[model samples]
Target: MNTSSTPTPESTSRLSEPVAGAPLVLPVIEEHAVVGREMVETGRVHLTKTVEEHEEALNFTLLHDEVQVERVPVNQYVADGATLPGVRYEGDTMVIPVVREVVVKRMLVVEELHITKHQVPTQESHRVVLRQESVQVTREPAPGTIIPPTASTPAS
Candidate 1:
């Protein structure tokens, strides 16, 4: 329970009006201002990608396949009833096609491809390359007042 004192009429009149002879001591009241901060959008950030090509020497390992073809002299010819293989591709290697006809069997035959994969790990240097996207920072002041860096950096 809250108990409060109610001022009577005489006490109210005395508080409002000062005495005539004696010096009156009035209480002085002061009001202070309150400052607050608010968040607002200042500017927008736009990101764009641009591709630029340049020739520069760089040392790195690249993944690729290289096919080496060696022609061996085949003096011996196939037999009359021998069948030849067909042409095909193995990985990055392609085989040349060669057709043959069997005399006795009367069957068609083609050449086959023997593919050998070789991975040669090498170090190479590339030229200067331009990046597509970059980071940029921009600062914008508020509408009413531009707060100084020192003021804004301080703790609230």
Candidate 2:
């Protein structure tokens, strides 16, 4: 029997009676969504390499050591059974003694060499050619596709 202000399809079905000695069973319903993914190709990029040349000036100081050799003749006799004289330095000059053997079994000092050093600095200028590489990127959209506006860094 109907016992509501208005009989509805949902209420009528819920109130139906079951078979004798059989427990009443309620039905439950649930909804779900199905998801999937697809791959897509957008565009292509082209790179171009180029070289640039220019002249630049370089300025610096050049330093070098200059040697001056002066030979002084010293004809002096050494003492008998005396050890030979070793090299000695006088201030910035290096003195090297040259010795000779005489016929009387004696050692004689023939000549002395004086070596002096000096530092000379000079300024110089030179022009040199230098090369630099730069790359430019060009974008090509796929067939029947639209390209968007974007910001990018400049190549050095």
Candidate 3:
């Protein structure tokens, strides 16, 4: 009889190992969102009409009208550092880079009663006017208590 015992083979079926270059799979989720359009408000608008006509051998007629008007209060927000290519935090003080202006569009309507009287008259005209208005700006502090910067006080 042989004194030494024969070696037994070990089972590798129970062992699990990760493989390289394996694709990872994840669950997909679907959701829906509601979107709305922006709202715009317009104030009062005025209209003006004028007519003129003339003739050398016959009678001529001319009519003209003038109008002046003003609109209601319009809100305009002037933001500072709005165009900078970085994130902006709350309570950050910055100068307004652009001048906030309130403008009104106006048009003049003209009609010729007679060609001879008008004498090749020009048509309508449009213009835009900028009006200066009073603006009030206010800001609120952060929700938490205020903490002084470390640079301001000496290290303890």
Q: What lDDT would each prediction earn against the true structure? A: 0.58, 0.90, 0.37
Clashes of each: 12, 0, 1
Q: What lDDT tens digits, residue by residue, belong to model 3 across residues 1-156?
A: 234566333333343333477665555789999999885433333444434343224234445543322232324343443442222222422222222333432221121111111123334444444344444444434446464666767789
What is the C-alpha lDDT profile of model 2 across 1-156, one tens digit per residue? 567889678666765677799998888989998898887667778999999999999999999999999999998989998899889999999999999999998889999999999999999999999999999999888768976668888999
Better of 1 and 3 by TM-score: 1
- Model 1 lDDT tens row, 1-156: 224488666665635566689888877889999999998766555555456565566678977777676443333345555555445676766665444545654444343435556787777776776555455555555567556566556678
TM-score of each: 0.30, 0.58, 0.15
Name the candidate, 1 or 2, with the larger lDDT value. Answer: 2
The TM-score measured for candidate 3 stands at 0.15
Best candidate, lDDT-wise? 2
Q: Which of the numbered candidates is closest to the native, going by highest TM-score?
A: 2
Residue 45 local lDDT, model 2: 89
